[model samples]
Structures are given as C-alpha cells and as structure tokens.
Target: EPEVTQTPSHQVTQMGQEVILRCVPISNHLYFYWYRQILGQKVEFLVSFYNNEISEKSEIFDDQFSVERPDGSNFTLKIRSTKLEDSAMYFCASSEWTGELFFGEGSRLTVL
Candidate 1:
C-alpha cells in the first residue's frame, strides 16, 4: 500500500529562523493534518485541511504557522519563525474521510 512520505527527516535550525516541512500524502486521501510531539509528550493536533481550505486548527497553530497544498500531490507546512518551544517531531497524516489516518515517518525539528 502507498504511504505518506515526508522530506528532511530531521532538521536543525536557530531560534527565530524559518523552516518549511514538506509531505506527500496518500494519493486518494481527502483530509490532511499536521501534528507534533514535543520530546516525550503526546501528539498534538495543529491543523486540518480539506478541499483547499483549512477545516480546523488548534491554538498551537498561530499566525507563525501556515499550511499549503502547492500542487496536486504536495502538502507543506511552513513555520515563519522558529522558537525553542517549537522543537518537536512533526507528522503529516491523511485520511480518505475522517476515519483512519496514514502518517509519515515524521520530520524531527530541533531549534536552538
């Protein structure tokens, strides 16, 4: 079965810098989401998108963060400015509807 794929499996950046994480979700999935796990913490939802519009977003997704589907197959998340608190493992997920989600290996972000 085809799975979600993410680029830059690991990234390191300085505080106040910018970072962009990229993913290619399962081709047939309609809903996409970005979630993050900070160190040993639980996974936290950031945003959800469908039909080229943002369906829902958590408080963690502030003005500094943005998500885009630049083309048919790519979904991207951009962090305008990085912060030490933003260090986490970012996961890209997709689902055909609202049910099961297929997730990528995750891109670990480390901010110093």
Candidate 2:
C-alpha cells in the first residue's frame, strides 16, 4: 500500500535557524494536514490546506510557521525561527474524514 513519506525521520536544528520538514502524502488525497505531539501532550492540529488556500488553523500555527504544496506530490512545513520548545513528532495525515486517518511515521524535530 502507498503511504506518506517524510525525510530525515529525525532532524536536529539550532534554536534560531529555519527548517523545513517534507512530506509526500498518498497519491489520491486532496486534503493535507500537519499535526504535532509534544512529549506528553495530545496530538494538536497546526493547519489544514486544500484547493490552494488554508482551510483552518490552530493557535499554534503562528507567524513562525507556514506550509506549502510545492508540486503535485510534496507538502512542506517551514519554521522561520526555531525554538527549543519546537521539538516534537510532526505527523502528516490525510483522509476524507470517514473517521479513519493514515499518518506518516513522523519526523522528529529536536531543537537546541
């Protein structure tokens, strides 16, 4: 079965540099989302994009973050300025909301 793929499964970056996490979702999905889970917190939605516009976003998706669908198969999250607290498991998920979710293994971001 085809699934989402994220590069660097793990990334370590400095506290003030920009970092972009990449993902390739299932071929047929039209909706794309970014979510993160801090050490002991619940999964939180960052943003959702479709039809080339942001459908919705949570408070955590502040000015420091942005997302893009650069081509037919890639979705990317860019953080303009990293923070130590930015460390977490970034999950890329896709579904038509039929109550099922397919998630990427996750890209672990560790900022220092």
Candidate 3:
C-alpha cells in the first residue's frame, strides 16, 4: 500500500526563523491535509487542499502558515515565522472524498 511520505523527519530551528515541511501523498489520492499535535495535545487540523485550491482551513492556519502543491506530486507547508509554541509534530495526510486518511510519519519541529 502507498503512504504519504514526509521529508526532514525532524527539524530544529530558532524562534522567528522560517521552516518548510514537505510531503508526498498517495499517488491517486485527491484530498490532502495538514494536522499537528503539540507534544501531549490532541491532533489539530490545520488546512485541507483539494483541486489545487484550499478547500478548508482552521483558525490555526493563520497568516503565518501557507501550503502549496508546487507540482502535482509534492505538497509543502511553510511557516513564515516560527514561534516557541509552534513546535509540534506535523502530520501530512491524504484520502479520497470519503474514507480513512493515510498519514505520513509526522515531522517533528522544534523551535527554541
């Protein structure tokens, strides 16, 4: 079975710096999403992308965050400025219009 894959399994950055997380979802999947979990917190939805445009986004996806599928296969999330609170395990997921989501091994971001 195919699964989403993320690059830079772990990242360390200073507060105020920028970071980019990259992912490649299942080849035939249509919807892609970004979710994060702060250390011991619940998984929080950030944004969903479909048909090459943003389909839905949570308030957490503020101006500091942005996502793009520069190519048909690779999706990327960029944080314009990192904050201490931004440190978390970011997961990349993809699925069909309706079904279970396949998530990549999360990329852990550490901001100090």
Candidate 4:
C-alpha cells in the first residue's frame, strides 16, 4: 500500500534553532493535519489545512509554527524557534474522514 512519508524520523536541535519537518501526504486525500504528542501526553492538534489554506488551527499553533504545501507532493511544517517543551512526536496525517487516517511514523523533535 502507499504510505505517507516523513523525513528525519528523529531530529535533535538545540533550543532556539529553526527546524523544518517534512511530509508527503497521500494523494487523493482532501484533508491534512499536524498533531504533536509531548512525550506521554495525548496527541494535540496543531492545525488542519484544506483547499490550500488553513481550515482550522489550535491555540498551540502560534508564532513559532507555520505550515505549507510547498508543491503538489509535499507538505511541510516549520518551527521558527525551538524550545525544550517543543520536543515531541510531530505527526502528519491525511484522511477522508470518512474514517481514521494514514499517519507518517512521525518526526520526533528533540530540543535540548
């Protein structure tokens, strides 16, 4: 089966550095979402984009965060400044919402 692809499954960054986590969403899906799990916490929604613009964004998505569909095949999340608390599993997901989702294994961000 085809799968979502994410880069740098594990990332280590010092506090305050910029980081870009990348993903390739499944083709034919109409919705894309980014969620994060802060080490042992429940998954939290950061944002959802559809029709090429943000459809919804949680409060957690602030100045430090941004997302884009840089091309027809790629979606990306950029963190302008990293913080220790920012360390977590960042997941990119696509769904019909029709039902569940196909999630990239995830980009694990580690800020030290």
Best model per lDDT: 1
Name every residue pair that clashes in candidate 1.
none
Q: For candidate 3, lDDT tens digit of each residue in 1-112?
A: 7889998899999999999999999999999999999999999999999999999999999999999999899999999999999999999999986468999999999999
lDDT of 4 by residue, 39-69 (tens): 9899999999888898899999999999999
Model 1 alpha-carbon drift over 4 Å, by segment: none
Q: How accurate is candidate 2 locally (lDDT)?
A: 0.89
Candidate 4: pairs in clash: none
Query: Which regions in candidate 3 have their CA more than 4 angstroms from the true location?
Result: none
Candidate 1 residue 34 Cα shift, in angstroms, is 0.3
lDDT of 2 by residue, 1-112 (tens): 9898887799999999999999998888888889999989999999987877788999999999999999878989999999999999999887665246678999999999
lDDT (tens digit, per residue) of candidate 1 on 1-112 = 8999999999999999999999999999999999999999999999999999899999999999999999989999999999999999999999998889999999999999
In order, candidate lDDTs are: 0.97, 0.89, 0.96, 0.92
lDDT score at residue 66, model 3, on the 0-100 scale: 97
Steric overlap count per candidate: 0, 0, 0, 0
Q: Which residue pairs show collisions in model 3? A: none
- The window of 10 residues in a row where model 4 has the poorest summed lDDT is 94-103
> What is candidate 4's local distance difference test score?
0.92
